[model samples]
Target: MPETIFRNWTSDLSRDWGKKPIQIDHSLSQNELFSKDALAELIERYPIEHYSLMRTSSRGEEKKIWRRGEVGGLSGHEVMAQIASGGLWLQLRELKLVDKRYHDLLQSIYGEVEQRVPGFDSFNHEMGVLISSPNAKAHYHADLPGQALWQIMGRKRVYIYPAEEPYLPQEELEKIALTGLESALRYDPEFDRHALVLDLEPGQMLTWELNAPHRVENHDELSVSMTTEHWTEEIRREQMLTVANGILRKHFGVSPKRRSTEGAGFWAKAVLQAGWRRSPWYKREQRKMMPVDFRLAPGTSTTIVDIPAYVV
Candidate 1:
């Protein structure tokens, strides 16, 4: 482990932490845990419920394709090799709960942040490692929690757009809060014109404003990255408001205007959202599991065999 996770921290970085899209140099790429061999070992033993293996469309393709798949009996190295071959990405989610080393690393990263930024306390911290194929693209999406992307290996181009209006409308965010679908936001190619585009390399990490809409495209090489998510009291309150407002608009056919996070309106909406969570409707409306449509071929590195669709 490096003595310092962030390499080029400055007063400006602390000031702009979550207010805008900022990329900073980091030392995690030097950590031995992120080495290809170590990652392969982790993947081999990772719990099925803690990971998501997805196959998506290649770059420049008109039609979009996203399917869930499984690793089957392949070795960890084989899985990495398959991803490197193209059109696939694996997310080892919630690393803190899956591995103790990662749990400690997560704590260390946040501990350093709290030390640098006074009064910025965050909780519900989670980390996921993403291994992606060459020329793979993650379509435009917006997340509810505070997010940061850290590049450990390879390179990727990231486009970050403002977290408002056509890029990330409030209703779209509200729907995500209710349905737990991050990719529900609509995207326009013209939005790229106003986006802050940056190419991320090893040892670099990017953080943007809360709920900012962004997309990623991998260079013609396999990419490895870590994504971190956290929530603060303010963020929790905003989420409550989003859910409550969504319920009003979706279920009751009522439009909510106030977006305050305090006082009577906020408390009332918070209570409403809490009640909605316990209702039968909430259970039915939650995101459904994606069926496993394919599995890695037994001995072939890049071949995937189609399987009878089944939910894991």
Candidate 2:
């Protein structure tokens, strides 16, 4: 069978802008485009391949992973012990293994999103689409690249804090060039951080700066959503450093002295510094980096200028 490469709705937008999060609700204004019936049928037709699931648990004050990999596989049964011990179970890298049929569905809806939003683009498949099982708990984490999350079914509340806060302090953007992002968020979970908790229904979307400190609390019922990565130079650097850190951690007893892009990159870290507290760089960067500026108005188009040559 031949595969279809659908038209790229975001090619123009990708070329002109850098990544930033913007919300667009009416991209699929028609009710039929994202109905509960359509979502349920899709899930039933394409059962998830669970080989990539990873479970993390708390052992006293610290967290640990009890089991990982396939459901019936050796690691899968071992996870039961961790669950009994009250460990958290979750999945990662979902888009990599989803069935091709869903790819068609994504492409179908993606076109409408691009047209209606004016300047949005589809994410790379490696970033994957994520849907939470009922009562799922996603520990606080961030991504290497900016993320766009479109809610297809069910409900979930998301809480986010400003990436840069005075108390949090931006020490050195260069630190990201050095430890990776995941480690940075842990420095201040209790800092005087500003928070926004979102209650999302079907068809709502939230796009935000990558590495922005955030977490998810899903409803007791099913929650289905899709996510994609918008590539950039920073993302490329983040991926390389994350891999480098993993290798060094395995081969040597020492942790890599580089930033991991998993959540909140070095820029967010540096913004924590006292000098940056006085500088205008953070706000200026925010305005310049956001790719699309959209409104609820119908029949509008957006265009960004001077996107770096490297991004796709």
lDDT of 1 by residue, 1-312 (tens): 547999889999899988999999998898988998899999999988888999887666678778899898888888998898877899999999999999999999999989987788999999999999998888899998999999999999999999889898888889999999887889999999999999999999999999999999999999999999999998899999999999999989988889999999999999999999999989988889899988888653467789999987
lDDT of 2 by residue, 196-266 (tens): 67887666777676556567766766565666556456655554554444434533445546465555544
Candidate 2: where are CA atoms >4 Å away?
1-21, 26-50, 54-65, 73-98, 106-123, 127-134, 165-184, 187-193, 232-312
Top candidate, metric lDDT: 1
Which candidate number would show the highest TM-score if scored against the true structure? 1
After the best TM-score superposition of candidate 2, give how far the Cα of residue 44 lies from its true spot, in angstroms: 9.5
Q: What is the C-alpha lDDT of each candidate?
A: 0.91, 0.45
Cα lDDT of candidate 2 equals 0.45
* Over 4 Å off, model 1: 59-64
How far in Å is the alpha carbon of 221 misplaced in model 2? 2.9
